[model samples]
Target: MSAAVTPRHARHTPGLLRSIYLPRTADALAFAMSTYGIPLLVLATTRSAALTGLAFALEWIPRLAAFGWAGSIVDRRGASVVFHLASLGRALVLAASAVLLRLHPSGTVASVTVMALAAITGVLTEFSYIAVETAGAAAGRRAGRRAHRVQAVLLGIDQTATLAGPTLAAVLLLAGLPPMLAAITVLSLLAALLALRTPPSPIAPARTPKGQTGVGLLTGWRTIRSLPALGWLVTGLTLSNLATGLLQAAGPVIVVKHFGQSTTDVGLVWSAAAGATLLSVTLCRFAIDRLGQWPVGAACAVIASLATLAAAQAPDYLSYLVLVAVLMAAEGGMTVVLRTLRSLVIPPEKFGSTLSATILILLLPFPVAGVLTALTPPDALGHVITACALLQGLGLALAFTRLRTDPALRT
Candidate 1:
């Protein structure tokens, strides 16, 4: 009876994983397309690095602001409802923006229109993100001791989307803007359709007092405190993102203005980086099983720091591109570590709220990075990248030291 049951259970696992992966893949690809495509559009229209950076800033500000409420909604409403609704909302917004852009092809009006879409979509993206993260965590919990494997698979899916999204978006952009916008809108609606098949949230709705929704965020805060290792990890990752964000926000400017590369080559750089990251994420599953999460995470941190510092002084586009790939590979490894740790440490009932708070904390530097990119001249981006790299190294060192010693972190 036990042996028969084991086989039966194995048969059902893939279906469950698919339920999560399919929708998540669609959603992530659409997001990645918009993320890179929007900045490219802004740069193409305005021909100003400053404006490109500002557009990047606009894209992230509302995302940061929405995390608190997005988390509360996910916790109270359940993941499926939040995920489906947010996906539909994003599709509608993109459709409207696409139509409006056709009317005003190029001008201040077009620029403002895209920027407004960026802000609105940013908020909707957060809601979907929080919902999917909650669902992923629930799946991880079901996997018990093998939860890290689930995280690795999910990270791999995300990297796969990243690998494809930019290249596809750039190709569509070549044909024209409408095609790219239509592609993103279609993917988003597909995500909504797939969301209907996802498993219902295992966490019971977090009961809040009447008009006391603020309690959700407060709980997230308290959960972070209760998990000191989580707090330290989030803090260190936040600092590391400053470097990554600066690199991302300045990528179009650096490639176009500094290296004299075409827009298509810009997409290729990220595609290559995402390929490296996907490989790294795959290797991480085996590495964690053998050497453990902390050791693996620490090694990735070292690699990312060294690679970033080197990239900042790269002598040519080829060397910079290679170094950036290395940096992102390391970043991917770190992400697997972070996600695995989160699933293991956070309490399930509070997972959605805590996840949101932690993501908000981690993303805090993105807007700052955008602002820095805007202010710094294109020629000086290298120096800014170098400075951010040093800070990332220092922060990671302190964070890992604390994490190693923290009683909450199980070996």
Candidate 2:
């Protein structure tokens, strides 16, 4: 008798999951490192809060520009190739940054060079993120798993990286920037290799006729326009992101100047928040099932807003840390609910484009946030955060009201 053989799908599923999970986790880790490390390094080197804010904003500018075309390109070429190329591009850019740091050591030239490299890497990383996430969903379908479960696992990996990456970056920065950049380069290369192993996502059929190459770029916008509720949800998320951007740009400044804490402490606070986010993600499905996506998301937005207001008034480091954790947990849960809702509402063929458009809307406010942070006085940062939170609360209320009337949401 022939030896018993494992089913092909069973054997491939584990490998497929690894391929999707490893690269995504690595990419998320690299992103988090850069997100925290770059700002910390800028502040430490320049001692100019304005420059730090500018650098943070610069990272997202290119991402915003690329968002218009990235989805169409990925849809036309397929996500696997885009993902692999983006990974390689990021690795090369990081390696270049490490080399430049080794050469320049410290100066105005060094700062400018590092900032430029960060912006370029940010653009590449954004593209990689979109491709990998789209591919992961496709892989889940291929593996015969439910979409919600797959999304939960992917979100878990992301939260885990967010939990660990910042702390790792802060610790490594204590050693030096070059070492941190080197580690990121290695991780990027590893992501590239793993991308090679990932199963290819089937490309969306071209929506435009032959000879109408750029027309596909509009598909996502049209899709969003067709879905009234999704359009409103995206609009609400844009406001939420504005508040998030302000917090991101100003949080370190608050820790360093107001709390008089070290970079290590900043990392600790963020790590705690990330931990809370992970816990919230784990509980998200239960909440969504019990309360429904719209109600849970609206409740989360309210909680996040309240936490933001409280965080602004926090008198000490510990209080600020606790409020930050609570805020991040609420935001994390809301993110999961929004993602699941998007998956349910958007057609499979339109996912890449529609999601890219939504991400673009979500990120458009970061540069504005950076400008506001740089312009505002340190003493008034709390007032600004509180105002943004209130605006976000208002947007969420309107969005939820609209969602309640949506026929798709009723089911």
Give the top-scoring candidate (lDDT): 1
Model 1, 308: alpha-carbon shift in Å?
A: 2.4
Q: Write the per-residue lDDT of candidate 1 for residues 1-411, one digit (tens) a residue.
A: 122211111112235545678888888998888887887777766677898878877877788778878877766666777889999999999999888889998998888888887788878988888887777777776776667788888899888877788779889888988998899999999989988875443433345332323346777888898888888988889999999999888888988888898987786778889889999999988998888888888999999999999988988789889999999999999898889888778865566678888887887788789899999988889999999999999999998888876643445
User: lDDT for each of the candidates?
Assistant: 0.81, 0.75
Residue 16 error, candidate 1, Å:
3.1
List all candidate RMSDs to the true structure. Answer: 5.7, 6.3
- The superposed Cα distance between candidate 1 and the true structure at residue 369, in angstroms, equals 3.0
Distance from true location, Cα of 384 in model 2, Å: 3.6
TM-score of each: 0.82, 0.79
Residue-level lDDT of model 2, residues 1-411, one tens digit each, is 111221111122336556778889888898888877778777766678998888887887787777756776565555667778998998888887778777887897778877887688878888888777767656555533244456666888998887778779889988987878888888888888887885542333333222322334377788888988888888877787778788888988999999999988887887888888888887876766566666777788888888888888899999999998898888887777666656666655555677788777777788789899999999999999999988888887788788886764554
Strongest candidate by TM-score: 1
